[model samples]
Target: MPEAGIEPDVVTYNTLIDGCVLTDDSAGAVALFNEMRGRGIAPSAVSYTTLMKAFASSGQPKLAHKVFDEMEKDPRVAVDRAAWNMLVEAYCRLGLLEAAKKVVDEGEGRAAGRGDGKYKRMYVELHSRMFTSRHASQARQDRRRERKRAAEAFKFWLGLPNSYYATDWRLQHDGNLT
Candidate 1:
């Protein structure tokens, strides 16, 4: 039998927070976190990471970043690789590549010794995705430029009658399609 009237500790609360993440419940996670603190249960790194995951899964990077900032500010906690990874995941979920890159660089500096195989893999994957996205954006711009150039050429050609426009075509100023 369990001890009667035993209050939930950080570990128990963390499990609840993780459950919130699995169910895509950001608000519930936040509420549980607040309640845990209200009851003087010091949040561990896992607690923070799980709550951040809840927001990240819900596509709320701003909220996830807020949770990360709270975790970073907690003096009792030593920010870990998982926490850093979750922060990156939050930004990446929203396609915020620049923010994720900044976080990765910060991680490289702050958690350098803590970087494991997982962090290395994520770093490589993020860079590859960024490279692909950049190239894709560039290709789109190139196609758009080509299309604009073609349109301008057609407009120029339309303005000419055998390489020259009628003088009167340029003179029509009121309700003119020329």
Candidate 2:
């Protein structure tokens, strides 16, 4: 669109990002998102959530969570239920029940339960599909490991790159690990 002298806005980026998801092109979605930001077109909640959807659909919960965290930190847009739900869905896609549950619990608890039972149905469905303690144990370990890594990321002397902490920290510290 820019080739035609048409300035792409947030909506344009969101639509293209969502298209990338439909095509299972998550890297393309990320590229478009970064390009959007690089061009100074501030991302809306829809832009963030759409990019998160691309990551979630591509089974990249880590990237989805990163987009979600950026959305929350963005002064231009408010983090709404759709953004929260996309994050929950990302964990669900990975069969990470504990992570999804944590996000679901937080979402449901927000605003004194305004969106009360929405996640209950989805969680029940996803849990029924698992029907084993195996996934539970694995998810528990993953959650713990994620938290420990996030906490330890504060050690600047370790010299981990910025990309490491920026993306990984969002999935930790849900009132359980400070």
Evaluate all candidate structures by whole-model CA lDDT and list the values in order: 0.76, 0.76
Residue-wise C-alpha lDDT for candidate 2, range 37-95, written one tens digit per residue: 99998888898899999999989899899988888788889999789879988998889
TM-score of candidate 1 on Cα atoms, chains taken together: 0.60
lDDT of 1: 0.76
Local accuracy of candidate 1 as per-residue lDDT tens digits, 10-100: 9999999998889888899999999999989999999999998998999998888898998889999978878888999898888887788
Worst 10 residues of 2 by lDDT: 154-163
> Where in model 2 is the C-alpha error above 4 Å?
113-178
Q: How large an RMSD does model 1 have? A: 17.2
